[model samples]
Target: MTSQPSLAKADSNPSSPGEPQSGGTGDTGDGLKAGLKNRHLSMIAIGGVIGAGLFVGSSSGIAAAGPAILISYALVGTMVVLVMRMLGEMAAARPTSGSFSTYADQALGRWAGFSIGWLYWFFWVVVLAVEATAGAVILNGWIPAVPQWGWALIVMVVLTATNLVSVGSYGEFEFWFAGIKVVAIGGFVVIGLLAVFGLLPGSDNPGAGFAHLTDAGGFMPKGAGAILTGVLMVVFSFMGSEIVTLAAGESEDPQRAVTKATNSVIWRIGVFYLGSILVVITLLPWNDKSITEHGSYVAALNSIGIPHAGQVMNVIVLTAVLSCLNSGLYTASRMAFSLGQRGDAPKAFARTNERGVPRAAILGSVVFGFVAVWFNYQWKDTVFDFLLNSSGAVALFVWLMICFTQLRMRGIILREEPEKLVVKMWLFPYLTWVTIAMISFVLVYMLTDETGRKQVLLSLLAAAFVVVFSVVREKVRPRVDA
Candidate 1:
């Protein structure tokens, strides 16, 4: 059997200033170029967590938990912050496009690395199809001339071309894409807060106040059990927050960029997820039919007498769908490239074009993404359902792995490279264990619900397939001398 790589020494040294960090494993210069600028990194970090889910999915949580839904957001947000903190600690020490997967290989084993890496790549690729389909639906609504499938193809082709052109092109597109989302959400928060405090003109909803939080159903109207259930509803929205850490490896100063992103997690969650939801519930009663009927954000805007609020939000949702598509394509490809570099995938995937983009890797991910889209249309009931359910719980699994990886990675850094510990996990070993237990509880809790049980079981089956493939590949492949 092939031996596991050592976490302590896996690209532990930082690259010299002003040079592109090697993208391949073990200091090899055969990888992506560091063409992304600081502004691009900053915006991607800010916008990475703001997905279409937040805009569209919050209504369900509000309907389920009432004003107490804030507790669910805070609980899940705290878990995300802790997870990102652990990731930031290792990423700052040894920045890599592989992100946590590389750390897993070093700390756990080749089996762990191969399985989690492929699982993550699969997750993003499926997300590509989901986001592409969503964007196509919105575009088709605007322009009836093109069919939904045609629009999906067009969106995929355009983003795939952007990724192929160069890493900078991807960064430039994401910066603006994320910029619009940040502005829209920020504006929503400001306007919603005004409406809540009676500061906005022509805005006087009698129910729009903090009193709505306690008066309506008296907080935890459905009982405290629903708060834990609410976690199942909102936790998936936090999946994309780790993209910044992955993008950091290709930046001019990976450590600095990662440190900045890690430090900002508190406010990002505070203002964006928790803060925005707080305004929404405050502006409209938790039980307001419009909150679920017209959607939470649109309902809040409508309550303030904003003209064309639905149309405005539709445009923003389309932007979010496209942004997710763009980022998903980039993420899946880079992960494929990382897998190749680590010898867990075909070596050709490690090759870069003149523009320093992993052409093969990008195309490879898109190919599967296109396939998934086709399945959505051709076999929506059978094949697509399985694909969707199989990947449903991967985010939770990835978080679980991150928690485990951080526990071992922290000790390795302390013993071998203390100076590189620029970003540390909070209350190491203690909070780390707490995070692990929390994740475990969520997984167990999922088994009780019918839908959640199907998702978790199917995801486990997919993970098992990858683990078996990894083990078999290790056994049959030719051995290399240490």
Candidate 2:
């Protein structure tokens, strides 16, 4: 491993000794303003994990694992909670827009930082196209006059402009976008719970009770093997949960925000993911045709006699797609800004305008986003499929890196600065090792599954390319010591 870089010392007394100085290499001074408020940060943290995946992807998990899909969610949710705890530990010590990328640099090396940072940025930029197309499909269905591609273009442009305006604009837009999702999911859970207890006024589905969990093949309908398969299906839904730590870098109090979001992961996962899935299976049998014919959420809503259930879900799902696109652009650009500040990317990407927005970084990501959309329209079956497959396992790769990075970072903090250890990972080395083992197990499991094998192989190919580029760049440029 490369020797860890020395942290830049603050001229003013730091709240904690581990806190980085404002002029450090990690500090861009690109003029990113702390405009995100506590409310915005709180909602972003709450709604970040509630993606379109939960609404749409849960059906497959339910089908694959039967009622035991709840177990899959709980397992993945535990992994995420552990991963985020480690991240929170580092982020609270020295918050930066670079996030885990910066932490990787301090704990591992430039190679780790550059490779992981660019890979993550690439992941989100591709997500922009995926999400915009998703939202556009729904809009085009509503107003048939607009072409699907045209709607995609419109959605991208609007969100791009919102991000370019300022960090606060992105925060405000996400605040309301996520608000709608929170309300929809919360309402669904409440109604479903009521129906489960026979409290709904006109509900008539006799299967809407706790007994449905066992009535449909007795919990492990497909056997214990299917639970692992369900993990692959639902694990990616948790990708955006780390975005709150990233956004916290731009908030009024970075430490407090990171700690709050980190500490709250348990309840968020319990209530939002596990709670919703339990309610879903309770409302309808796992094998019911409607669960797949209409999405799990829609079927659950329909079970309780909600009018226009499909249409209502379409609106919420569309909102989720837009929210993902908005957050994706923000995340990718901020990462680009961090790379530039750290000398891994072109300096132009680090430049911000009067609004403290990285216009070049945002535009750069949007350019690739547009290109990906074009590929989707032209060569979706081949080129687009490759792109999609290659990035599929990036979330796992990132989580693995976080675990390794935290292992080293924890030691460094203890030796050099302990006071900054405000948000600690549970059980230190033991739980950290357990998280690593679980992640490795998932990767090995993916190798056994055909589709998953293809994705992991292709994603490794992409990661290898970035690693080579980072090594060559470091050799040629050789970072000057701070």
Candidate 3:
């Protein structure tokens, strides 16, 4: 295997004022160019907090837990906040495209890094196909002349070209895409709140009020146990929140970008997730049939006499799907590049073009993504389901690894470079351990349900396969240190 040098030593050496940092805009120690500006980082961070799942998947959570689904979102959101904190502590000190994967290698071992990094890349590539299919469905609806698969191919190719160009191009596309989603959600929340209080003029809002929260079945319709079920339903929706940490590595000021994203995550989750869900439950009773029939967001819009609500929401959802596709491609490729640099992947993946783009890595990820899209078209039930289930639980695994890595990395950072601890994990080992336990509880709880159980078993099988491969690779060709 190629050399796997210690990042601690590399990051410890201060760069001259004239020389750009490893991931900075000028020629990096690694080949990647820093093309992301502060504005791009800010928008990416905000966009990461809002995902397509929030719009598409909240209906089932509300159906299962009644209005108390807010609690499930809060619990999962808090878990994500803690995980991002631990990640931020490491990322701010030593920024890299690898993000938690590299930190795992330094704190745990090569096996951990190789496994998590590849799993993360796997997760995003799968997401690309999933999001591409979703976007295509909407596009095919607007223009029936184009088939769903045709739209999917068009969307995937366009975004792939965007990523292949430069990091700035990717950021620019994401900036506007995310901006539209933010405005849509923000508008929905504001208008919904006004209508709920009987303040909006000329609207049939069913006299919407706080009574909707409890009048149906006293907050939780299916008893308290459903909250756990709701947790299972909503947990995966928060998967994209960590993408900001990975994107920060390519920013002009990675440490500052990391710190800002970490600090703002709380309010971001509160406003985008908890806040919007609160509006939905407040505007319409949890047991309302329209919510399940027309979807949570659309139902709320319909209740307020909004015109063409479905189409409007379709447009918003399409924007979200495209944004996810854009970011997923960028994220998967960067992780692959990082893996190559660490000697965990092919050396070609580490090479860059004149634009400082990892052409090989980007194309590699897109090629797999396109293949997955084909699988979705040709054999969605068999091969596609296997890919989906195997990747379903990786978000939890990544978070759990971050918690473990932070526990060990905190001491290492304190001993080696105490001054660089600009973003410390809250409450140290105590909160970190609590976060770990919560994630473990969620994973264990997944086994109780049929769907969740299938996902866990399949994901574990995939993880074990990768771990075994990593061990064998290490034994045959041990990593060399630079």
TM-score of 3: 0.96
Model 1 C-alpha lDDT per residue in residues 376-475, reported as the tens digit of each score: 9899889988998899999999999999989888877777778999999989889989999998899899998888899999999999999999999888
Candidate 3 per-residue lDDT over residues 99-202, each given as its tens digit: 99988888888899899999999999999999999999999899999999999999999999999989999999999999999899899888888998999898
- In lDDT terms, how accurate is model 3? 0.89
Candidate 2 C-alpha RMSD relative to the actual structure: 3.7
Assess each prediction's global lDDT (C-alpha) against the native: 0.86, 0.88, 0.89
Off by over 4 Å in 3: 1-6, 10-25
For candidate 1, report its TM-score: 0.95
lDDT of 1 at 263: 93
Decreasing TM-score order of the candidates: 3, 2, 1
Q: How far does residue 252 in candidate 1 sit from its true spot (Å)?
A: 0.8
Clashing pairs in 1: none
In candidate 2, list every pair of residues with a backbone clash.
none
Candidate 1 vs candidate 3: the TM-score winner is: 3
Looking at model 2, residue 342 earns an lDDT score of 77
What TM-score do all the candidates reach, one by one? Answer: 0.95, 0.95, 0.96
